[model samples]
Target chain A: MLKDGRVFVIPCSGIGKALGTVGRAAMYEVVEKLRPNEATTICLPLLTIGDEAVLKLARNNPCISVDGCPFQCARKNIEASKGKLVASFMVTDVLRENKDLKPKAVTELDPKGLKLASILAEKLATQIDEINNNNR
Target chain B: MAIVKDKVGVVSCSGEDLPEGTISRIATRIVLEKLRPNDTVTICLPLFLAGSEDERAFARVFPTIAIDGCDKRCAEVGTKKYSGKPVATIVVSEIMQKYPYLKAKSRGKLSAKEKELALKVAEEIAAKVDEVLERKKRGDSN
Candidate 1:
């Protein structure tokens, strides 16, 4: 049961490019489409932890860390900030669900990744809704 | 006198966000500011952990930057985890701590001051990167 309605969708900034076609697609579908009005999607090169805008949002809302890989930088960053993370997702987790995606190594940005991202986004949205409902 | 090779990496750890006045980005921008277009840099992040090959190629080509939002160093640690040697590390807390009002109103976005801070941090990083490059050149000369 969570009281906060915010979703923090963070992807490990640069590495996501490797998701190539699939990764790009996922970014557009999930981040562009499902990122809640109350939420924001942040992307930066591996360096530059959020400047001020990121801190403001993180300090107030429940966080959702999305990593393109297992390192889970997005999730780890939140935890390090001493903020509570309400949810989490990984790009690999999405890839796991769609075994047939066969992601390429070069990371050109693909629609398959977008489709997977959409699916993952939908899953997270549902989870958030459930949590929000439970809190009520 | 310096025993450790001055390695630097830029990162943005703004917890679930694209850090605007991000020191890491600013630092990167500064470092690359003078670099020729043929000179490429490798941007490493925790997200690319699975892309081992890509990571290697990136590191092999350019210096690394690690930008951390909070104290966690998500970007820094990720770079190290993948064996990408980061010469410099920047934390967002350091910036926000110095300027508490940046968080005022809790809009969850970067303020103007924050951007200024990020660029400053970026410049600092650029300086460090130049220092390391010089050292590497010296080492090569020797």
Candidate 2:
């Protein structure tokens, strides 16, 4: 079962960008572990531009956004471009699940965070897989 | 008159308390070690925003290099906001892009090669600092 045929890992590249560290980890989960057919990471610039090529590529497909924090810049960028977002995964939620993971420590990508990201990616991928399968 | 010492500062978004990537930690340490007797070095992390009057302590330094993890530019922008001069900004992605060989197994872990490249970027930053200081001195003499 596939939920959506296309998936986009979009993060805000603003001055407060947190997704690169966290959301990026999640993207790896979806691509490597979950094995999605189409998964691409788009920063603020792409969405901000709303290029015709990008817009057309996404016009027929549903999008799932992964944001690093609550700012929702990823979702906002999509809306600003008149695009629809099927779902969103906020990284803060993942961080909350793992209390042992400290935000203060700027450690390298820890296995715990990776595990958490993969868990979320799994859920998202499963949902997408189901949705796509049902539509067929 | 007291001799004015040139200052070098290392700033990262991952607060001073947290341990960052091997390149960040190791490269920063190397930069500190290379400092001359007349040079001062500051290692700051973004978590210092919670500290009272910490901004004042930061502005006193010069040639600040912000080592941001991603494009969010937290350390780079914060240094500018606090009135601290940012001589250079290094984003980890830019460094990784320079050395495609540093790509991690999965975006979650940095490969050993990536760490080495990070050290190289840090060295470049140090070289930039030296160039900036020398340029400043020349301007001062004019």
The prediction achieving the highest lDDT against the true structure is 2
Per-candidate fnat, comma-separated: 0.23, 0.05
Per-candidate chain B TM: 0.63, 0.69
Query: How many clashing residue pairs are found in candidate 1?
Result: 50
Error of 2 at A15 (Å): 8.3
How does residue B12 of candidate 2 score in lDDT? 51
- Can you write out model 2's per-residue Cα lDDT over B34-77, one digit (the tens) per residue? 53324546533322332346443564445567766556565676
> How well does candidate 1 score on lDDT at residue B79?
61
Per-residue accuracy of model 1 over B32-72 as CA lDDT, tens digit each: 44332123244545444444474444443445556566565
lDDT of each: 0.50, 0.53
lDDT of 1 by residue, A1-136 (tens): 2323555555544432444223323433444456445444544333233445556656666656666655565567666655557887776777787877655533233455445656766776676566556667
Write model 2 residue lDDT over A32-107, tens digit each, in one string.
5675565544333333334465565455566666666555656665665666577777777766777665333133
Model 2, which residues run further than 4 Å from truth? Answer: A1-5, A12-20, A49-52, A55-60, A101-107, B1-108, B129-142
- Positional deviation of B68 in candidate 1, in angstroms? 12
